[model samples]
Target: MTFRIAILGASGYTGAELVRLIATHPQMEIAALSADRKAGMEMAAVFPFLRHLDLPKLVKIDEVDFSRIDLCFCALPHATSQEVIAKLPRDLKIVDLSADFRLRDPAEYQKWYGQPHAAVELQKEAVYGLTEFYRDEIRKGRLIAGTGCNAATGQYALRPLIAAGVIDLDDIVIDLKAGVSGAGRSLKENLLHAELSGGTHSYSAGGKHRHLGEFDQEFSKLAGREVRVQFTPHLLPMNRGILATVYVKGDPAAVHRALEAAYAQETFLQVLPFGALPSTRDVAGSNYCHIGVTGDRIPGRAVVIAVLDNLTKGSSGQALQNANLTLGIEETTGLMLAPLFP
Candidate 1:
């Protein structure tokens, strides 16, 4: 019972990542690959690391035979995904890796993305794809929206604490550092080696980052109020990973207990022992999120740190995890690879 899968926007970072993971999957086959600009080119030309495996040649989205694909991973960019997905077959299961359908409210989407959602009805049907938190919904959904890399890292650190009522929701703060790959494969002046290699700088400060929409939506829903966390993202001089340092007002011991208990049974999420901290290098290239908790020098405060590969666990891996559930397969299938280390 192999599942035939189609990957739209196959030339991008996340798209290439999906191909890398699915190539070795026991029950999944890459039947089609779509990259409008790269159509007719072999994937190896775009991502040589994937050259070892035999795969379908890239094609345009309209050229893909959707009727043969059991599932489609839409790795297209934000605004572009809505237009493409709206025209796809309604019954085909989809895991969208873009920001298109992540926000349930179209008005919220417009507020953050600067435009009204083109597929409001589809947005209504899409389930938020935080695999551990929304397992049941993802298992029954036809469309699942993957969270932002930064959003996923922060939530893995705070969701449990918020759910247990162990933290002060009013004073939450998140400082995240992300690798260059999270920006995608597009060329940018700041991403050049001469500009990015030597130092780090913050962008989207002052509550302007688009992922704040996700934080507001998910956190508020959990606490049953409008919980807004102060967030600032920094660009690190690396190629892959995200490290989020979260500050919360709570009993440090209780924060550790809540996190350990919540992720005790999760296969891909690891909660380190209290007082221990996590590093992005520890979880690089794997579908695993490592979280550590420690008490602040000031009483009644705690710092929760989480790290994961921005390309793997943050986006493509999360998408595949949800796809497994949507197809009624084992959730850990094709996603148990260990982190790469020197």
Candidate 2:
């Protein structure tokens, strides 16, 4: 039973990635593709790499026939997704790959995103799409909100530690580095080859990064208190992947055991051996997050490093995983492909 799917914002990096992964899926088919700017153009025209496969021509969101779409992956930009999703059929199962619905609190959403949510009712009903932590909720919900790529990476490293009470809640710090592609395919002065390549710089420093809203919301909920981690995101010259170097004070062995126990059954998350670190290159182009733990040279502290392709495990792949559950398919279905290697 193949489910018919529609991908909104199909001309973006994550949207093309969804097309790439679903091309090989056994129980999913792309019935519609929407990219407002690229409407009337073939997907191959926007992404030449996808030319080998036959796909629907890009169209406007309203052009899609919702009655024929079993599920919709909304990969549109943050502020735009809420408005677009609000008008979709109420019965349609949606997996939003934007920040619009991630935070449950309307006040928090406005605080971080700089605008009040247009669809408050939908925002309240949207389930957080961290598949590993919210699998049950996701399986039974009609709307799922994908976490930020950086937020997802950092959570993979710290969630278990927080749950196990193995780390100091107030002292956590997350220093993340992300590939250029995570910024989206939009034109930016800083993302040019001359400006981006051969150089790395940090942005959203000093706890100003928006993903901190997620860390605060999720980590606080997990610890039963307000837990804020100092988060700083750096832009790497590469095209994909995210590496979050997390600093925490805890028993290294206990942290390792907590993560191992938490994700032992998870198919997409891997915990490397202690003292061994992870690299973004290893998990590139796949729905896999590799985590490593090591004690800091200074006693009573540990370093947790997590790496994954921001475009894959961090966004589209995560959306697809939640969509499978919403459609009553196997959670891992269509997502078993191994990490891509050079």
Candidate 3:
């Protein structure tokens, strides 16, 4: 019951991550690997770190023969993935790591993304790929849209609380700090070693961040009302994790209990002891999210902090987890690697 996979944008961090994990999969193999600019080049040329493994040479997406791919991980840029995936085989199973199909509403998609979906027909068929909550749906979906790394971290820490009626929806606030790799392998003046290595600053503040759309959509659905949370994300000087600290009005004890109860059975999600907070270093380079809960002096308020490697658990790890489910394979397959510690 081996599943053959193709990575449509295999040169980026997330794409390479999928390759790294899938290489060790007992039941999955790389059937195709695409990177337009890196086409005809060995993966080692693009990412020297990944040179150890013997993998298919990178090819252009247009050259991929879908007939040979059982599943495709669409790691292409947003807006771009929509058109690429639309042109793909209608029957090919897909896990998109772009914002293209994450929002079910085309209107919402257009509003935040500033363009109409290129594949509204297929968008309607894509399921949100949040591993813990959407496991059942993912198992049956022909196409699954992976969530934003930041969105995934926040949701993991709070969705269960919202579902269990244990938090104040209107009072929620989220502040996230993420490593530069989450921005992708592209070169940006701001991301250069000179500028980004010495300091951290917030961008997309005052509710300007696009991922808030996903948080709003998911939280509102679970709470049965329109809910908005003030979210701000900052870029850190380092290179591989996301830490989201969420504050909400709720009994801290209940917050802790709710999260514990929700994730008690999950192998990749870890809820820490009460009053403890998690650090990005703790879960770096692993498909594990360490969440901590604390009680506030106000008694009815609490703070929750979550951490995970943005490129791993936040993206590729989640993709691999959903792929495992979709292929009817063990959900934890090829994803049991321990976190890379300091």
Candidate 4:
């Protein structure tokens, strides 16, 4: 049976991406599209790349008939996401791509987002949307919180090592470089072509990046103790991917093997040969994550490099993956497209 889907915040990048993917999905149909500011406008006007497909006109959230939608993908911004989702049909299946429900603890939400979560109860009920790690929970979940692109990339590199106890837990570092698209489509003076075209710089440094909260929460939960990782995110001049270079104290061979074994059966995760590395361009515009491992000159040290399209595997693609599970469909449906390469 084809599931009817609604995409809120349809005018944004992630929302447009959802349209692109779902347009080809045989088991899902875009029943409604909502874009508060651009209500009544055609999605083709906002994203001409999608002009080939016929999509519903964009409307406001309240204008949508949630009762008719089988599943809804919430792509609205954080603070607003909770307010909107709180009023959505509680029984409706939701795959939220915002930061609103990622953190289970309201205290941690407030600490990182600088505000109290408006939907505390839903926050607690929303399952983490790391597809491979939480597949079972997601299938049974009513709401799934999509993880941060950076957080997801880092976890793809380190989660297996952490679980296998092959890496030094206390000495982990994630140095990530992300394409500008990860910042969202909102206009910022710094994101202008004149300002960012030929340069790059780290924005959230010194433990100031909000996604660290996810790292702390998830890693700590995995280790059954407090696991704080040193994470720094850099904004690159490019437009569509994230490459996380994770440093860990472990045997490189063992780290590679752990990741290989963990992701051996995972459709989207590809662990490369030892000493091999992945490039963002290799996974651009695709729902795949390519990871590589190499040993450092120093003994007991390893470097794990993980790459993915921030817009695809990092966000929209990940959202769709969870939606499939929630609807009891094959997890890889409409998501096995090969990455774009120059």
Candidate 5:
């Protein structure tokens, strides 16, 4: 069966990506596209790269007939996503690519997002959308919340180590370098070519990044205790990818072993040979996350480097993965495309 799909926030980066992937999906069809500000415009006008495919014109959220959509991918922004999703048909399957339903605790959601969750019940019911870790839950979930690109990168590096008790819980550090696309397509003076093209800088540092909340929540849950990691995100001059260099107190070989074993069966996650590393360019525009491990100069310390295209594996691609599971389709459908390489 061709599952009918609706993509809200269709004018944005993630939304456009979903359209690109689903355009070739054998089991999914784009039934509707919504872009409140860009309503009535052709998606081809918004993203010329997609002009080759015929897609529905962009409409407003209220204009979509959710009753006909088998699954909806909510690529809208933070608070707005929850507000829109709250009014969506509760029976409709949803894969939210925003920060709205990621945190289960409404209090934590407020603490990180600076507002009480408008859809607390739905938040409680949404499954975390890390396909590798939450496959079973996603397969049965009505709503699946996609992870922050930064958070997903760090987790891909460290989750297995933590689960295997091979890493130091108290002294973890995630130094991430991401392209401007991860900030979304919104116009920012800092993101302009003149301002960002020649340099690199850190935005949310000193535990101020919102994804830290996700790291704290997920890591703590795995370790059965409070696990806080120092996370600093830097914006690179490039366009699309995230490279997270995670430092942990552990044996490099053991950390490598744990990750290899955990991801051995995962289709999109690749752990490289020991002492090797991954580059963002290797995984650009693809749904694959390449991770590498090596020991630091300090004997007990290990460095885990993970990379993926923030727009693909990080957001839109991850959203599609969850949607497939929720719809009882193959988890990797339309997502096994090879990474773009120069």
Candidate 6:
């Protein structure tokens, strides 16, 4: 049975990506699309690349008949998605691409997002949507919350190592560089071409990033204790991708073995041969994440780098991956597009 789906916030980068991937998806159909600000406009006019697909005109969320949608991709902004999704029919499956439901604890959500969760009951039921690690839970969940793009990158490098006890628990350090699109489609002074070009600066430095909460939650759960890693994100001038270089105290060979074993059967995640690292350009525009591991110059330590398109694998693609599981569809359908290289 083909599933009927809706893209709730169709004008954003993540929403456009969902349309691109789902347009050709064999088991899903786009039944409704909403762009509150761009209601009544053709999706093609808002995103020219999507012009070729035959899709519904944009509508406001309230105007759509959600009862007909088998699944919905909530690509709305952080706090906004929570309010909108809370009122959605409970039986409708949802994959939320926002910060609202990522953190499981209600208190932590408020601490990081500066507001109480509007729908605590739904928040309690939401599954963390890291497809490779949480596939079992996702397959049975009604609500799935996508991870932070930065958090996803960091976890890709560290989660397996932590689970296997291959890395020193206290010394983990994550330095991430993300392209401008990871900041979203919002307008900001710093994202302007003249300002962002030729220079990169760290924002939310000194462990101030909200994604760290995710790192702490996931890592601590793995090690069965509190684990905090230093994470600082830099905004690069490019349009899409994330490169997270992680430093850990572990045997390099063990690091490679651990990641390889964890992802051997996974379709979207690729572990590069040892000593050969991946570039953001290698994964741009695709759902694939390329990870490489090597011994650091310092003995007893290893450096692992992971690359992915922050907009795709890091956000919307991950969203769809979880949606596939929730709806009992193949995980990699319409997600097989190769990375673009120059």
How does each model score on lDDT? Answer: 0.96, 0.93, 0.92, 0.94, 0.93, 0.92
User: What tens-digit string does per-residue lDDT give for candidate 2 at 157-257?
Assistant: 99999999998888998989999999999999999999989989999898788998999899999999888889999999999999999999999999999
Reference-based lDDT, residue 105, model 4: 88
Candidate 3, residues 1-342, lDDT tens digits: the string is 887889989999899999999988999989899997889999999989889998899999888888988999999999999999888888889999989999989999988899987889998899999999988999999999999999999999999899988988888999999999988887789998999888999999998888988998999998899999999999999989999999999999999999999999999999999998999989887899999999888879999999999998889999999998998999998989998878
Off by over 4 Å in 1: none
96-177: candidate 1 lDDT, tens digit per residue: 9999999999999999999989999999899999999999999999999999999999999999999999999999999999
Q: Estimate each model's TM-score.
A: 0.99, 0.99, 0.98, 0.99, 0.99, 0.98
**Model 1: how far residue 86 lies from native, Å:** 0.4
For model 5, what is the alpha-carbon lDDT of residue 174? Answer: 94
Candidate 4 wrongly placed segments (more than 4 Å): none
Tell me model 6's lDDT, rounded to 2 decimals: 0.92
Show where candidate 2 strays beyond 4 Å: none
Candidate 1's displacement at residue 72, Å, is: 0.3
Give candidate 3's error at residue 199 in angstroms: 0.5
User: Candidate 4 — worst ten consecutive residues by lDDT sum?
Assistant: 115-124
Model 5: per-residue Cα lDDT over 3-85, one tens digit each: 99999999999999999999999999999999987999999899999999989999988889998999999999899998898
What does candidate 4's lDDT look like per residue over 79-160, in tens digits?
9999999999989999999999999889999999998889888887999999999999999999999999999999999999
For model 4 the TM-score comes to 0.99
256-326 per-residue lDDT for model 6 (tens digits) = 99999989998888999999999999998899999999897889999999999998999999998889889
Off by over 4 Å in 6: none
Q: Report the Cα lDDT for candidate 4.
A: 0.94
Model 5, stretches more than 4 Å misplaced? Answer: none
